[model samples]
Target: MVRISGEAVELANEGSLPAQEVPQTSITRSQAVKLYISHALSTWNARGYEFATILFTASAYPDTLVAAAIRMTIVYFAMILFSSVVGRWVQKSPNRLRTLLATIFVNRASVLAGAFFWLLILSQEDLIGSEGRFSLAKNDTLKHILFVVAMSFGIIERLSASGNLISMERDWVVTVAAPSGRPYDLTHLNAVMRRIDLVCKLISPILISVVISALDSVRIGVVYTALTSMVSIPIEAISARRVWDDNPSLRVPKEVPPEGETPPLQSGTMSWRTQLRQYLHDSKMYFSTTVWIPSMALAMLYFNVITWRATFITYLINVGYSLNTITIARTIGSLFEISSTVATPRGVEYLGKSYRSVPQDEHESEVGLVSGEDSQSVRDTRTLVGLQRFGLWGFTWQVFNTAPVVVALFAITAPRVQDGGINVFASRMVDRAADYTLPAPPVGWSIVLFSFLAISRFGVWIYDLTTQQLTQTLVPSHQRSSFAGVETSMMNIVQLFAGGAAIAYPKTDQFVYLASASFVVVVLSWLMYASWVYRQRGHLVHWEKLGQGLFVGGR
Candidate 1:
């Protein structure tokens, strides 16, 4: 038995529905709005602080790009290694709200301490002997240690938060919304969340630029971080309590069945290995879809090449542009990203609606339903529908996957001429110059490039959302965290190799070419695998059906 909004109700038996309707346990619209606001605030503050810290560290370090890369690698590696344990703990915790709050506190505290230490180090430069100060500054081992500590705390916080969100969303879907016969509308919800995220991205760059320009010290950035953290901490704490109050079962620990008693079928008590095996067996299509990881890794390596080739800040300075100019450009790009994200779901919805309007014969073909005795028109309609769906998913994957490659290509091929002691380029076509420098490209070119990058970013977000929905569909509630951990761990393993490769050959054209070729091979392999899976499964590998089941229907 459990309490929902002060009403006593028995837990629904697995695979059965009671004759009487279960009172909705889903969060009210008001509660959801509040949760969204709180989450947005916390995420924005956390991400802003992180961005500021990275920028500050880059400014302080000599090889800024390499330092950033190494730090990011360390963070991802830590997440990969620790996520499984963290996930299991979250699932088993008696008081999940407390657990989540504690993690957030620790994460913020660690970052705050690191910021203070950084300021302390800078302040003590004159007090320390020249040799000692030089050693501290030159090696930067202390800074690295600080970053590792901060990032470790961040990993725990993020893992806890992810588990909490999934649990809440699951409860809302399975218990509340479905029973209440309401449309889930996941796409719309996602769009709302993403819109908030985009706003944060748009604002963060401007804020950082203003701070950096005004104070000319990284410490000021820390102030913003601290202030935001203070606000976010309380809001998160309040939200956690509200969640617990609304859903007491979430706060209770799972009880093991006594000896000689039959355990609940839905209990997620399988060994980690067994769970992983089962998940893989059930999600063969998903696994096939992820064959793009190696290609993604190669793309990441290509990205590093472009990033390190010429630091964006250095390039801007060399091009006779102010820091503010770069910030403005970035802010505009972020706006574009926001717009694209906001628009994409509408576009997809429109396409879905349009596709549904075909003749019944065509619709049956689109959905891969055909009889041996079907007419020629029906078969042709089916073929067209199949092609449409295939093209949609394929285009989506390519758009998301090709971003880094496009950036790399732009880095290598953008026209350039000599200017301000560095290579520069103009917007229009130009003759090859002895010195690699050119006049600033047309404003339109900059806008186009920025928009392209923004669209790519949006595509990545969509891809992530799609995969997350798929995972939520495939994994049971109790096993969600563990499954997420395993998936993240696998991805990190691939990224580790990619990061290592990039670090080993930081500046090499051959490496980029090799990576690109590897990406092409992996992509081709993925396509073949997808085709095979489609033939076997009779449908393209996608989350659309799952989405429909979860959102459109109670199931």
Candidate 2:
């Protein structure tokens, strides 16, 4: 007779999968506090930005704000050169805290020193000007110097913040999910994203507008931004620990990344060529050098000129609306639309788990097998497949995809900028109150432009949300920090060039140019929608769910 003993019971239990495995990572709460100081170093918002706006509108020269641009360029150049060096210097070293401490010192401590010295400078200026012994020239120089120093610290911190966050996010995500099994299913992970999006959508627009306005104002904006970072960074860093539970995978860095390896390639928008380029390339500046390689080698490569037009138009619409509203709104909206599993815990349980893994034989479906042994691999692979295909949008979001187009826009308009600029044609008419004794023609023109912009904001809001999500989801988690940071750099770079173009831009027929661009952008939308469908056409599994089981519902 077969007799079961305590040893048999122990053996049987040992054979079973874990009830729950929660893992904790080494990126501890203390380290998280230090990591965020980089934000203060990296952001370089100049004081008196409103003043600069007025000056730029009235004057002919590159203002002190442009100096802020130069400083940003220098900082990034240093960051690009030094990131790996910094990465190495701190890699597995106890002195990683030293780097964080140094950034903090430069950002927070140096401000006190500069403030004291600048107060002396201001005292001298006051005495000299009061005595009628000073020129506006002396005061301007001192003011500019003080402003640049404060902003430089800000820029350095912002750069460090981006790198710091990326590092934390990567490590934290892996640690949190380590207990689930061989492969983590993102569908199970991102389901909670919907609530986040909903909350963000409703809350962000208002909060962001306040944030931007406060950031734009005097003295208060800088302090507010620094304080916000202090709070937000710590929270973000700590939240990662919750994901990993009961897994042996949680601890210090190991030989392997948690998500494991990429599966062998099947069909994807990413060609072998693009993959090779992305893998081997350093300094994402080189990313674009290869997009043309495939096009040239292929017999038929069609250009989507309309898509390009639509994107620019979309971008215009985005900024045309209250940028503060769009920035926060879009961020929250994108967060919400992301798969609930990837975003929330309750979302995962509700959307992902089968109430009964063993379904009725008559109701047995392809999904029923998701709980089986072999089924894990298939489900995991499908999620990865779905995740990886997002690289198409990723491909578009990267430097190689966007640089040439922006450079071309700059090149086209760079020659015509004249001194004092074209007065932002629409702004010229709108800034003056309608009742404030303006010419009849000007009043009428202002009304039309404002009306147009008001109607356009809604469309712009939608596009902004879509594009932000596309950027976030399309990228691999490992590379997203640098990639997202690069977008900011691209915006700054474009604006710098655009500033010069704006200076030279003549006022003649300004509305004509604006209207034409806007019209072209709207018309191109349908075509862009078509291209999205075209790229998605061949994927057999990518289908819209038509019935109850087809649609994913979150908790």
Candidate 3:
């Protein structure tokens, strides 16, 4: 049996009522707490590897923007190539626990291998050079070869890590939270998971950057990452195993084929053309769904080169900013993002309360639905309406909040007369600012730039959480990871373009162009999201009422 409720479809057994009619097993408070803790540990370990890789690129090749671009582009390309494959594998896997553990093992092993390769590169560098700079000896060929090998390992690591993320964040969290007879658990779980991610993102980079900058040796940073990742493997595994053992529902595979599509034939028996056709059909399936708008909007945000990312960090280092200074500014931005995670749940709760307080007949009359519908379906409709409203609200805020970043870039990079003021110390750079021994920005202007960037993260994360939850709540179970993997690939494709832009304008003075281009993409993303909201307005709560409730109410 199938039931439709305001853009979402629920399926059940042929003889049974809709799945929403069945009594769900409620999770104990202890079990909920354990899930949150396990998710935090696993997310922290995953983000450790992610941030460590960024630090590796930014620190190891501080003076070479082109080298950093190449390495980052390679990682993005690897995700584009392998995310879908990993997604399909996870969808077909019978044992989620074994699949998750094996994926983590591969990710950890690749990190260790990359570290070994980086050690080789460090060995080839001359130790008697300038502080915090890696000057190679006459053997350029050997160094290039070692760089390629390290990036190869990086590709493998990113592939497996991307797979792990899709499995956990996209699939398992929803599966575990939805059937627990609690509507708010999914939102709370997403918020806490993202909070843990932000926390790790803030700490790992700072620690790695401080180690490399203070010690003046990239080798030490590499060793520290390798050792910590080695220790974290067992801990992450154990936490994940506990969650899996306690939730028997997670073990049962969800394999409902998508409506209107035939099941795929055996891979070994299909011809190459048949496989190609199947792949195209799958692509169309994703694009045809309502979820694609949010997916594409989020992906468009990645075509940004001027954000607080690896390329921008590399640019800051090249422009004479100290690594310690860069990490401190990023930590400030992360704090705002962490707060956004907290704010998101409150916003969700506010919307839920407002929607639930509406009279059923009034809601049904406004939307042209029957008055005597099942109460569960009515609840489901209200939930969908709330998600859609919040998604639109978040997007609207993001559009306005991101505009300041472009202005900040233009102000910081403007050509002006050299002023005699407090000089910020430079850590890594070749072209020191004229009239100053070290390349440093005027202290006041530097703060403004960092402040604009930091504040923008508040809106960015609110939108991120809303869009992610909307996708999680709406997408079908069988296609969750596959859809998420494609979504990841799309975002990386845009990021690849951003990396290419950095390669084209590989100097600090030419950063304004990248910033302008990124803002234009942000506007375009807002338009796409706004259009989706307009199309779904019929099923959503009244826009004026929702706006008044969110903006005007003291509650």
Candidate 4:
């Protein structure tokens, strides 16, 4: 017997398998409200602080591009290396909320430490001297020491921030939504959370840009960043605490024992070798799960280099597109992404409801059509069916929309390079009056690419939200963090490859090969995802029915 919102639903029994009970749990409207507020403030502060610190680092260093690259490398490496550690820690923790707070404190504290060290280095003005036309610091040893310490703390901050996000977004959100037993609530929450993130993504960088523009000294920007981080600590902490206390579900997670705790390996502590072995074991388990299909699909999408990425912006610039044109185009793309976040919940609900209306007899015959115990009860309830059905819909929709991007990528022709300092061009283009005049020549082609890219953002985010919800709902509670951590690392690993692709063909004229390679990668990703979707077709709502219901019936 299971109790959800005071209604009882008897679960069917499986032969030879022990049954698990569903507890009576509910998430009230007030709890949901507070959770949203807390999540919003916490995410905004973290993202803003991160963007500000990156901006400060870029401005502080003598070689801007190198600094940016190094910072990105450090951040991604930290995420890849430590995300699993945090996941395992959270997975085995007695108090998950405490773990969340621990991450937040460490993240904020590290920001402060990094900023302080940077300030020390920047304040040594007398030690700074000119090297050719550029101002270079002369106290090599002290400067190097400070720089290294600052970056080291930066690594710590990134590690903790990743953990914090894993806790709040990946772990807690699912935990909180579970009690309601409604996929719509889960979809709604996921959409709102993503909306917050996208909002920050759109606004935070621009604010950092403003701070960089207004401040005469890089040191001032560093100070401002430190202060902002300091302020966030209390706000994030207090709000997170309130959310935890208000929602009991968020506080209690089933504690799984730390891996490699056998008598031989567990003499109170394990060695590094044992830890590595344990991580590998966990990775193997994560990759073997049914959810890994969509996880890998999502990760592979990051491999496609066709979007409004920085590389694309540079390509446009090298091909004679004005910075204003690129900025406006990217902003338009972002707006479309934001719209997806807004629309995802409705999309999920629409599909969910339509799928629910299909006769049980229609779905019952094919339930458990997938070769796993997981899909056995897919039609036992509306919730179970909705999970995979909408996920497939969103996944297939995005892949269809990506067709335009493939065309856009192949549409781009080899560019004739333009000679100018990127920094000078960026600065002048930002303040320069907008040229409403129609773009001529190569710039026109770039616009076509940007237009298709903008349109695709809507589908991309819809797919993202659906896949996220699917992962959250399908994976068991205790394993969610571990799976998510490893999944994040996988995404970053693929991203590193994407970055390598850019490095391999960096010249403007070489973009054609890059584009060609990207197209191939996109096709590969689509094949993988499409094949999986096809395999699950028997377990899913008919595409013709779903389409007619969504667009024609407006249900």
TM-score for all models, in order of appearance: 0.64, 0.44, 0.83, 0.81
Model 2 over residues 1-555: C-alpha lDDT tens digits? 011122212322322223354233233333333323222222221122212222221221233345534544555454544343233222222222343334434433443433333333333433335554322334656655664564454445545544443333322333333222232322322222223333433443344336546655312333443454444434333333332222344333322212323222234466756544433332342133211111111101111221212233333342233444434444443443343224233322322343233334433222211223255423332332233233222222222322333333333333222245533334435664533221222233323333333333322322333333223333333333334333434433433433333334324333234334433433344334334424332232223322443445722
lDDT of 2 at 46: 18
Residue-level lDDT tens digits of model 1 in 1-555: 000110001111221123243333445675557656655765676557657757655655644476677667776766565555555555444455565566667656655665665554443333233654232443456656655665555555555444444434433233322221123344445556667766876676558758867976555666666666776777776865675567534444433223322212235566767655544432342233322232232223333322212333454444445566666656665665576556544444432332332334532322212123334223322322332343335335544545554454445434443534332333222444434534554555555544554444444444444334334433444544444544555556655665666556543223445345445544553455345335433555346555653342233
Off by over 4 Å in 1: 1-23, 59-69, 94-96, 126-184, 247-329, 340-448, 508-555
Name the regions of candidate 2 deviating beyond 4 angstroms. Answer: 1-138, 178-217, 220-250, 254-281, 284-373, 385-555
What 10-residue stretch in candidate 1 is worst by lDDT? 1-10
Scored by lDDT, model 2 comes in at 0.33
Candidate 3: give the clashing pairs: none
lDDT of 3: 0.68
Local distance difference test, each candidate: 0.47, 0.33, 0.68, 0.64
> Where is model 3 poorest over a 10-residue stretch in terms of lDDT?
9-18
Worst 10 residues of 4 by lDDT: 1-10
TM-score quality measure for candidate 1: 0.64
Ranking of predictions according to TM-score = 3, 4, 1, 2
Question: Cα miss at 237, model 1 (Å)?
Answer: 1.6
Deviation (Å) of 241 in candidate 3: 1.3
Count of backbone clashes, every candidate in sequence: 9, 47, 0, 0
lDDT of 2 at 517: 42
